[model samples]
Target: MASLKERITRLQSSALFRGMTRESLEPLAKILNEESHKAGTVLMDMNAPGDKVYIIEKGRVRVSRVTSYGEETTLQELTAGDIVGELAPLDGHMRSAKVTVTEDAVMFAVSGEEFEQLLKSNHDVSYNLLRELGDRLRRANDNIISRLEEQRVNIEGRMLRLHKLTEASKSINSTLDLDKLLTRILEAATSSLDADRGTVYLVDDIKKELWSKVLQGSNMAEIRLPIGKGIAGVVAETGETINIPDVYQDKRFNRDFDKKTGYRTRSMLCMPMKNKDGKIIGVFQLLNRTDGAFTKDDEEFIDALSAHASVAVENARVAQEMVQNERLSAIGRMASTIIHDIKNPMSTLRVYAQVMKRKSGNEEAGKLADEMIHQVDRFVNMTQEILDFTKGVSSLNIVDLEFGEIMNSVLDFIQQDLEKHNVKLLRETQFKGMVKMDQDKMVRVFYNIASNARDAMPNGGSLTVRTNEAKGYVNIEFVDSGTGMPDEVKKRIFEPFMTYGKKHGTGLGMAIVKKVVDDHKGRIEIDSEMGKGTTIRILLPAA
Candidate 1:
């Protein structure tokens, strides 16, 4: 125990006691006892009676709790000029924690009874403690509120970005043009994420290559990279998203693109473009975030853009395929017409050689006579058809003939052929008027249609040729109980070499009839239904 004067000297040196005026602190200072503690000495055992309050005068004291593992974690370390055990003095409760002197320490201690008596008398001291407690509580509350507000802002920002991305994906899926769709993707991606640069690469899986389709930024056109060689390639190969805060330090970053474009890379975000099947179609790479490096929000938005791009690219390919089909159909028709012309002349030459061989006898006159007859026979059979085709009805002598007379000539030529096949012909010739037209072309038209009618009724069916006059025109109709056509076939029937019954045609007969009719300023209509029958109606002007 020390004298009251010595105790006062120690207390006066302490910050806790110094907060009071010299006269006011004098009483509490004299009541305090100076106690010396050694290292490893327990100052207070947990849950023990709280008798005294302590003010550390020298050395240090540690306040700690025993953890579940029986290890001690120091909550606070009190050094000289520090106050402890003050909270315990406010209430006569068992100590909630144990206190130990970590090093040799000298502290001034006062009893809880003395603390209570001093608290009742010193209103100014009590008021100061109350204010300190209130300040700590208010500060704790403010800290909690600030953290919660920050969390809420983060959540809201993510939701807004998600909604915009969903809307953009929907818009991109609605178009089929590759260029337009890719342009929309760039605009939507950059705007949605508030990114500074964006580019979409279309993957050529077959070639194992990635090609840029749309590139946009402040100076985005400057950057270019090859597949399997850069950040874009990593994302494309692994089908993962990559975000690098600093491209300069990353070993995976290739500087060739920077060297070529003269654009330095600071940060990069890249994602793989995948189709519905999770097949990597391409890559989308963004460079140098304007504000800060791209975060998780940017990786998510790039994924959305890539998904929509895959569908758009597929649709464009389908449109291109359809166009190609139409072009091929046209070419087939032209080839068939050329073949028909060449074959006719060859047939005439073969016939002439056969005829000449049959007429040949031994040597001179007999052989000459035989050769002349054979050559004439061959010439008649071969050149006859070729001559008729090349020198069409336009060069034939014109004649004023009744429409029924032309129909009867064509009907007569096919009558025997039809009877042999057990086919029926129903002729309803109503036109009795005359028309000035090429007689040969008119014969060719009727002959070709009648012949086609015979071929169509392979199992022997009815054929009807009906004639009528309507609106200053003569109309002739051919109805055959033959396999009809679908809409697609019907539209293309007039096109040369477009044939349905493959085993029975060179596909040129109807085409020839169509051309002749067209040349004569005639209109022809065909109506047919699959498995039902076909009706061919030819209309010509009446003179």
Candidate 2:
């Protein structure tokens, strides 16, 4: 489009070719071919051999190269009066980067060999080219320094997160209480992630549910959901991380809890917490990030925190279990000593009471003697219950006796205790069949159940002791009209130390009852409801 003089004028204005004489630029312009390219055209490709050098006469071109991650990164941009492919020709190697036309452009292309010769023959042009290359090198150096500074800041931030995590893990790991440990983990995780609130759900494998004790102000509320129900549940089931910036937009978000608690959840990040074995044990759900949506860095930090939390959780659970086992062992040792020392004296007291009843024919004194013997037997039964539970003592003095005789004895034992508590005992003995049982232990079983019923009926209620034989078993039911158990307590009723609303004894009454029944190859079933009453049915093999 321009004349020869105009083309030479343009060449002289270029920074790399500036200060060149007309004679020096004449031959360079004469050999030049003007090429027009559309946007997005590749003028030079990375790693391609140097064939030509182009002087941009119009529009823009971008110099970019692929990074190690296979991402294309723009190095620099060249506009009109700038040149591309000059470095390849100067260095006598392949192009270092891909150059693409960002805007429709016209360029003056000269063969690489000719461009190299022009640089050598023109002294002033060569000096200007060196100056241009030196400016580019300085820019590259600045870019490197800027990147290094950014990386340094990132590394420092990561180090700080790691330090916080270490302290948090230490605090959580030292506690044997699973509840307190989970609470600390949630607190530390929320602080580390800069979230307003958080919850840690533990997987209940048997129930196929995810449950957590979420702290609300000074109280902790138990929350449970099926493995695939909610955000945390999904993370628990899938073992994947979920980051939702706008929770309201997600259909899975339930606003009911937020509405009830008067809390608004804007963003959420949930991730699976896995044990050391890489098995997902739970999920950490963080809500309403204080800053904004959770970033990649937050995700990475939480991923690490989950690892520490999982290990701590596992340790706390194991420690709690060991503590229970050790406590039971200690009780077993104490019971063994008591049985050795007390059994002989208790037998002598029972024999003396029998003699008193035979010698003193007074009706009231005889009744008093009978009570003394019963009281001695009760003390021995109490000690034996502990010994049986802790020592796994299953030896039973099996005898075939009328089931009614056992029920009548249990009724007489509990009637006195029940009368003192204003609880009425109604007896309905229908099963006359013989049962293979240990009479003393079976009496303890019936007495324990009746005692628990009496305690439940603190405000004067009726207990019906009924028996019936069916399906090769004799069913003895202690139906009480008293304050019953909640599902939570009922589920763990047989576990040692589990108790509800009782203040008098070690919470091992039901546990011993279960152990005694289990030894007789019998099973016990319980039906209870809050505010209603409880029915404990013990079924023994009918002889």
Candidate 3:
């Protein structure tokens, strides 16, 4: 058993009671009741009224509850620096859990009446205990509420999926066109599953391969994958839903992909994409579910999502085939017209050149004829560009493209024009990365933007071109210190018929720029202030 002086010393040592003035706890010290109990003695029982609370001075006590079946569950074991029975006194309720002596224990007990008397005299101690009790209750309640909210959110998500699937089914049944159907399917799959990124991979069962057919995401730039690899491969081989909460931690996750692109794989939920006959046609993988792991609810939702997607993909394929046939017919007609137009002009130019060579009398006439021929050639090139732009003929021919090298070529191509216009070209080529793209198409995208900058700064202000790496993408910035466009002009700058200056300009340059960016699966952002300058920012995926 602890002596009165020893009990006082123990209480004084605790951080909770040490801050009180000596005068404030004088009554508590003088009236402190020291009691000793053997091990296994019940100090406080469950359902008992709370009249007194105990502060352990020495040894230990087990606070526990006995169930109806006589099983004991220990709530807490009280040792030195421990207080029990505060919960009930603070709430004016019965003791909730039993406190028993687990070891020979010495304690100081304070009755409710004495505690009230102490509180009336020592307001600081009373207020401090009240605050601590209140904080504990509030924290417990907050934890309960947070868990309830999570459950409610999960339930609501399931209901929303059912509603979305109903609408998606109706839309899928009504669509037969392949491109439009694919767009709808991807949009639905992305939304219904609540995934940050969703992709449809067509499986060639014979070849045992998976190829990305369609993808959608807020941050999605481009898709590059081969079959029999990674999470998608797991789905393909097992024909089961593979829910990988952390792909990076999974031993089966192929890091070869991360090596290829500088992007890391996080979470993935992959399921087999099947057709109407329940035949596995491909694998569908969704990455980084926005909320958490693809829960049971998500799996159900994705099952429905995949059902609609599979049908739409097949229908779209058929529709696309038909569209291709029609496109070929139209191209054949356009080719004939182009041949006639091109050959007739070339024949006349050849005849004129021969006449000039044979006659050799009028030098000015010959010079004028030669200049006219050159103009005709330029017109032909411009016509071809217009044809390519209007037809949306993206170059499928891929090459290892060094971005800095191509940017240098573009800068060189526009250097002479910049000199003619007295524009100071500034190049900040900090990026040294590569991409798989068509060289011609990439050059065209840059050329269009740079040329527009030159035209904007005709009076010889500086034009700045910069390149750098961004969040999983490469960014190129083109800034021109020109008489910037007004809000009205800037609003329509990318339109096919919008031109800021030069009466003879075709106004298709920016429009073509937009097309090239779309072809590269990239984004363009334009920022301009009237009378300040304009900046065009382009973001493309890095290889």
Question: Which candidate gets the maximum TM-score versus the true structure?
Answer: 2
Candidate 3 residue spans exceeding 4 A from truth? 1-166, 173-229, 233-240, 244-249, 252-268, 275-282, 286-307, 317-332, 341-346, 361-543
Clashing pairs in 3: 178-316, 210-227
- lDDT-based ranking, best first? 2, 3, 1
Across 1-543, the per-residue lDDT of candidate 1 in tens digits comes to: 767666667766665554667678778877778789999999997888888888787898888778789987655667887667767667768887789999998888888888878778988667765664565458557856775797799889878877887888777877777667767777787777666776877776655767654334432232334567777877777887888889888999889868998988788888887889988876777777888799886776677667667777777768755654444444444444544565666556656655555665545655555545544444343334333433342344456677776677668767867999888989888997977566666666776777777777789898898888989888889898987766656766876566776576546567667776777778989998877888899888888
Give the per-residue Cα lDDT of candidate 2 at 212: 82
lDDT tens digits by residue: candidate 3, 101-158: 9899877888877776666677676777677557556865886688689879987877
What order do candidates take by TM-score, descending?
2, 1, 3
- The segments of candidate 1 whose C-alpha lies over 4 angstroms from its true place after superposition are 1-129, 148-156, 214-227, 304-543
Error of 2 at 16 (Å): 8.4
What would the TM-score be for candidate 1 when compared with the true structure? 0.40
**Residue pairs in candidate 1 whose N, alpha carbon or C atoms collide under 3 angstroms:** 348-382, 351-378, 352-378, 355-374, 356-374, 359-370
- Candidate achieving the largest lDDT: 2
Against the unseen true structure, what C-alpha lDDT does each candidate score?
0.72, 0.87, 0.73
Worst-scoring 10-residue span by lDDT in model 3 = 213-222
